[model samples]
Target: MTQPHLLYVAWGYPPCRGGGVYRALATANEFARSGWRVTVLTAGRDTFEQYTGTDPSLESQIDPSIDVVRVPFEWPAQDADIRTYSWLRAHLPQVWHRWRAALDTVTFPERGYGPWRAPLERAARRIQETDPVDLVLATANPYVTFAAADALFEEGVPYVLDYRDAWTLDVFSGVTLASHRSRVGRWEDRLIARAREIWFVNAPIRDWHADRYRVHADRMHVVANGWDPELLGGDEPGTETRGAAVSPMTVGDGDRSHPRFGYLGTMTRMVPLAALIDGWELAKRRGSLPPHATLSLAGYLGYFAVPDPEMLATIERGRAIGVSYDGPVPKQDVGDYYSRVDVLVLALGAGRYVTSGKVFEYLATGKPIVSVHDARSAATSVLDGHPLWTATESIDASAIAAALGRGWQLSQTADATQRDAARAYADRFRRDRQLAPRLRVLRDVATTPSESRG
Candidate 1:
């Protein structure tokens, strides 16, 4: 039997450092593991290095059998170089921005990524002509990837939509972002209408979509984010698994009195940095936390290559209160940072629908976690039964301070069984395990005749 070919359209693939890239890389690799010939279409390396930063180590993790095609993806909006701007853009930045925004959406409803549709469409057509794709799976945020998949679908090639997060619904605000009459609304409606299956990161998002599009409800599924074992599965040679032997003290440091706290993953604007700083301060001064307890952040400052200035400033100010930013950690070195911290900090934006991808990795570490997001967040379900989990009643500093104090306590007091259970609870969320059922369905499609399949 001939091997089935899979075409994956993703804007944030390997080297584009962030949470989304892991999902895209893992998805494509999983298909290859299941005996499919996978080819990924993504933006060129320049897109990442120039705009969205990169962790080149992730490229090595891609399946060697897969063919990855990189195309030119331009982001005029993200270009921070002053020399590249026009006279009007330099003189009247606001007016120029509006003009560019309008022009961007003319081709596709998405603003920053709409222009990428053309390059992706061209690349998709070229790939089809070369290999005759059997199936297409697209992950979005540039959502433009779906347009390329939709183009193939128009030609009777079936595709799946993997929304790492919602597009039409503002997960942060619990508000509708666009209407059916709007361009973005129509584009999503068309894409979802044609997609063979639609995937979301969590149930709240899936439920929201199901409420809106009852017709597509059954077709929608929640494909929860799980940690990749290839990266954080276990300890490497000479190293011990974090939480394998619980140590209340920071690595190599004997001071058990001042436990170290850490937060990993991209530090997007969605992160509650301000509140976290205030909470950390309050926790140290008034709460049960040790006055000298230090919280170190290990990650990029923002989603883009040019980190957010305001966020950077805030992290700088936090230094006075024992909060320090250690900078971005490469994918391979994430474990090292995880091992150093006694407790993990999970400060997220206020959103019931928002679920952080790093939560899975945090659970896998078997370390105690402290969540500072809203109590109603979908993540509550994920962390509900976690043996060493500490959550805040609200996003208030008092609540966060109390939770932080408790988390530090858990880090010191959690027994080996509780530590083991923390990792064991995450066993069900292993990347391969999460993808297994979905892969089984896709396997049936791969076996179907190319002429009649969708």
Candidate 2:
């Protein structure tokens, strides 16, 4: 069969360590592996470095057959080093940013990335003209990529949308960020009206969109984010880390001394670090946790790799109570950090739609997990039946402390059987498994007549 030529639009691709980058990377490679000629459209090198720092090591994961095109993107607010800024941007930063935001919206409604529509459209049109694009799959956070897909669709080319994260709906708070009558809502309606498929990472998100736009409900799909088997070790049955469960009574070995609890992944302002720190202190005071139990926050403080003095100060206050910031670990070295920690902290903001990509990685580790977010999270569904999971019913320090105590207990007692079960449960969420059906669906859609898809 002649391979389908797919144009995959993702603003953040390999090297950009943004949360959604892995899914985007996997989508591109998965298409290539499924015998599709994939072209990845993303921001240039400078955008990653100046905004979200790049991970050059991640490039190794991309399939050689796939073509990656880096288009220029300017994010003035993220350029922390004032010296690198132009005169107007340096002198009147607020005015420059306001002007830029206004200019960006001319192409689309999204801020920071709306201006990318023209560049992406031009690139897509040129690529399609050179070698006809069989299908266009655009992933979004900037949502402006929808404009690129819309541009192709205008020329009678069919397109799909990968809603990596919620747009008009605030995922963290599970609230309507913009009404359907609003500008963003109208754009979403117009885009979905023509999309062959609209993919969301979870059912709740997919259902929300489907319900909101019932006229285009059949086009929506749920594509959950799964762990990278290469990074987390492939689905080998009966693995050591596979079925172990955490015991509540015992803490750690006498020789090891300190019981290690680590939170791995981006440490953004939304992470509820203050609550975590306060909870750790509460746990220690209530004798639910050992005095020497170490609470380690490991990973980049923000999307961009720059240090935040204020955030650092927030972490620093925890030092007196056994909390430490271990700094960011690279993607390649992430497994090493996982190996060293006894318990994994799935610290996230409260929301039914907020499921961090890190959760799957935590599941793969088979380590006892302490869910630090509200129990109402959609993540609860994934971790609910797992034997070694401890979750908070609320976001209070007391609830978090209680959850932590349970997690430490689980870590202390969980044997190989429980660990194996945890790993096995995670196996179902391997990236390949999650993407397989999606690829098949895409293939079916690609073969459909353009008019039928429209």
Best by lDDT, which number? Answer: 1
Residue 354 lDDT in candidate 2: 78
Off by over 4 Å in 2: 81-93, 235-256, 449-454
- Judged by lDDT against the true structure, how good is candidate 1? 0.85
What are the RMSD figures for all models against the true structure? Answer: 3.2, 3.7
User: How do the residues 1-454 of candidate 2 rate in per-residue lDDT, one tens digit apiece?
Assistant: 6678899998888888888888898778778878899988888977887777888878887888999988999765666677788888878978998888898787588887777788888998898889888799999887988888888888878898999778888898778988889888899889999888899988889888888899889888878888775554342222454333221122235333478999988878888899889999999999998888998898888767686677899999999999999987778777777777888999998888878889988887877999998677788888888888988878889998999999888887888788878877776777667788878988977777677864
lDDT for every model? 0.85, 0.82
How do the residues 1-454 of candidate 1 rate in per-residue lDDT, one tens digit apiece? 7888899999898889967999998889888888899999998998899988999999998999999999898878778899999999999999999999988887898888888888889899999998898889999887989998988887678889999789989999999999998888888899888888899999999999999999989889999988776686363212344223222222324366778899998888888898899899989888478877899988888787777899989888889878888888999887778878888998888889988888988887888899989888888899999999999888878989999989988887878788878878877777776788988997777678757664
> Whole-model lDDT, candidate 2?
0.82
Tell me how far the alpha carbon of residue 174 in candidate 2 is from the true structure, in angstroms, after superposition.
2.6
Q: List runs of model 1 lying over 4 Å from the truth.
A: 233-254
Best by TM-score: 1
